[model samples]
Target chain A: MTEPMFRTPLRRVRGLGAARSGTGHFWHQRVTSVAGVLLTVALIVIVISLLGRSHAAAVQILGSPLIAILMLLFIINTAYHMWLGMQEIILDYVHEDKWKFLALMSNTFFVSVVGLASAFAILKLSFGV
Target chain B: MADYEARTSSGARRPRPISPHLQIYRPMLTMVMSIVHRITGSALYFGMLLLAWWLIAAASGPNAYANVEWFMGSLIGQLILFGYTWALLHHMLGGIRHLVWDTLHGFDPADREWMTVATLVGSIGLTVALWVVGYLAMGGPR
Candidate 1:
């Protein structure tokens, strides 16, 4: 039989490519998603608890250390997870290289702005500022 | 080495083959769920803005909080929030389904359908239950 022309299966799977980050993106996405299963549930409960509370009441509820920490965790986890996801979507659909680069850049900016703002708000509330 | 050098010198890239086009398959629950997973995820991406606004308003003090609260308490706001709730829960369940598959289980044809169904039913049930609890917490039937 003739020798196989393509790389071996084991060879193909090993090592990072030109991007220097093989599987890192996929791995981090899954890790964050696993954390998200619990965070999302906690988030829903927190929102439900605040349903009809007054401003001061909502503040009081969110001010507690436990709740504030959970909120911060959820915000950070979600921001990262969604950024990874949207990057995948943009890479897949936005075929034009110029537009694809622009989309990816915008995704980073948007997630960072929203995430930092939300985190700041939580910190302010937690510190009673 | 010479062939490699020549190819590199050319600096031209050939188009790569892509997966089969989507039109080949009839719609199925698995396919539908996969699409819904992406859609809900995309929706929740924007939904973060709502969340950010809520937190920022709270931080900015009572007057800002009250204005945000009033809008959130309005009919349109409630409708938007209701949709957001369902999307959030649905995407979370979908993520769990993915996590399970990543473990190399739940791939049976019947099992795949069941998980998709569970994702759908569970999200709707949780959304309704949470809203019911919210209404109840608001001091019952209005």
Candidate 2:
């Protein structure tokens, strides 16, 4: 089959190429992987700092602006990276078309839920709400 | 055909011939590491859920946060936390390994073997060292 072209601007902005060979997914995954590595270190610091501390103290630590922001970034990137990683796994393993589509949808939903849930918690704590 | 994705997209359906699975190929250290990399990545999914719960529990107020904290302090929780710690470190090393490959070097057999061993050793060493520091930080309570 020949490659499909999108004359529409909306589809073009989405990075779908003529051969569907866009680098967006690869780029996102790599960028987030690097970010996840750095953020993971920052996360270990926060956890270690929280160790043996009270609930109030832990909350106070997490609610700090810097920790909250870093944690949010870590959570968001990790979830998205996970979605990309799992998508590749499902594509490689799930051969049947029906199951593949279903699995893909579930992957998207699951990642979004995890990301959103983490973001909400972080934002709430950061705002001291 | 190697273009199985394209063929299937065109609505002609057949039992898509898959490339050789691990069964057909003799498992080497590097090959095993590749599969281990994938498994570690998947392991982080559940680990992420645990993290999310911890964060939410912290935000939810004192008692809720205390309950989650206590569970994490329990025996099974400690074991899971230990595994999570190791998995995170292992996966991070795996990511670094890939990043090195992205530079277009490290494809030689020796380099590949060296990296697989490095990742395994580095992750295990880091996890153990971190736990030791953690224990000491707790004033030798354990």
Candidate 3:
């Protein structure tokens, strides 16, 4: 067969032209979205169970290593999924170029801070530190 | 480069036309509600961080836990909690509606309309029920 006429770097990458790399983000967001749906229900049940209990009782529940680990995972995944969803909303509605950049940056920063703080809290609680 | 010219001349990289956007379609109640579900779902992400903080602080010590309690007992905290509860209910009902749709049911226009309406009403109902339960748990209006 004759050699392919076009050898541009962009053309060499499979599925990289015109279609964009959005499919990965889209699929990831959906996967995490479904995960968040399940996690949220479990979280709500946990919180409701804790309600009306004294602060000390709540502490005992959270101090369990198992609960701490689950909370950490939930926080991280939830923040990441939220960030992805908000990015889509910002990209859709924020028309100004500068504002869009700022929005994206702030979104990333907000989610990161939330995730870090939550993880730190869980670790401190689990370790009694 | 030769490849660049070849691709360009061959019209293999022409700008693709974009389809019309949301402006072309009339707004509907279901569409608005669906968007709201996403907005509230996003809000809960940040809200859960607060919950995690409270739980952690409670686990940490009396001092740390007291601080969280003080904040959550304040007027502002109650207001925030109210909003959080409503958001939770809204997102929960919205999720149930999505699960129904996933099962390939509720496709009819009338069913879709009823589902949307039910979610809104169910959210409000659940919020009210939770508050009532909370009130009773707190000794019922003193």
Candidate 4:
């Protein structure tokens, strides 16, 4: 067989080890985290504005397309970012092998449920359904 | 390195130290604050369910929404809301701390401590100020 072109001697010899996904996960965590901060601030402002208001008043405010979109965005970012952060926490602390695996799975599941529920609620309100 | 390989292959029993953690190190301010940061981050997870519930209730109907709104105005509900507010503020400050670190600042011992203190104080101050403004916006407490 012909030798592969542009292969370093090391590649031809020892070769590369595992291509870890750690870097992608790290960058994603940071990007989502930054988005989360902005969305969270927007949400806090919305909630504070709604405080002491009647249900109709609050709903009217949220029904506005801008607020509804922002709320949905906030929920999505928070759910994903929270999942990533919780996954790191569980990985670091949950030393028990079985429990660690279970906790990791639960983290994803919980965030998914929360995301779906919140997104559906936002859509329902936005569409007046 | 060679000896490490040999030890592993030989299957000789060796004493291994337990993980370095809270017991090994003296508690420091940053240590306590860092743990609190994680706690607040986690708290936001559960606390946010309240927001979800409110939205769902609102989408359901005006009457259903009012049920949640009324409860939120109750004394106990207010307390929980207050705590949730603090948690949000605190966690936000912690996030800022992380962002600052990301920019390659605050790695110095003194600066890190100062930022830690600022995170705590700033969150409390901001929460109180926001609440004050919120109450004022509503034309003062009823």
Top-lDDT candidate index: 1
TM-scores for every predicted model:
0.88, 0.85, 0.74, 0.85
DockQ of each: 0.45, 0.47, 0.19, 0.39
lDDT of 4 by residue, A1-129 (tens): 978787667653343335445366677888987898889889979988987787778878988899999998898888888888899899878987889999999998888887888888888777774
Lowest lDDT block of 10, candidate 1 chain A: A7-16
What is the DockQ ranking, best to worst?
2, 1, 4, 3
Over the stretch B1-94, how does candidate 4's per-residue lDDT look in tens digits?
Answer: 1122223456975555546767989888888989998899889888878888888887788788888978888999889888898998898888
Q: Write the per-residue lDDT of candidate 1 for residues A1-129, one digit (tens) a residue.
A: 865978576665576767778789999999999999899889988988998889898988997899999999999999999999999999878988789899999999999999999999999999975
Candidate 3 docking category? incorrect
Predictions in order: lDDT: 0.91, 0.87, 0.77, 0.84
Clashes of each: 0, 0, 0, 0
Candidate 1, chain B, TM-score (2 decimals): 0.84
TM-scores of chain B alone in all candidate structures, in the order given: 0.84, 0.83, 0.82, 0.83
Per-residue lDDT value at A29 in model 4? 80
Which ten contiguous residues of candidate 2 chain A have the minimum total lDDT?
A2-11
TM-score of 1: 0.88
Better of 3 and 4 by TM-score: 4
Error of 2 at B124 (Å): 0.4
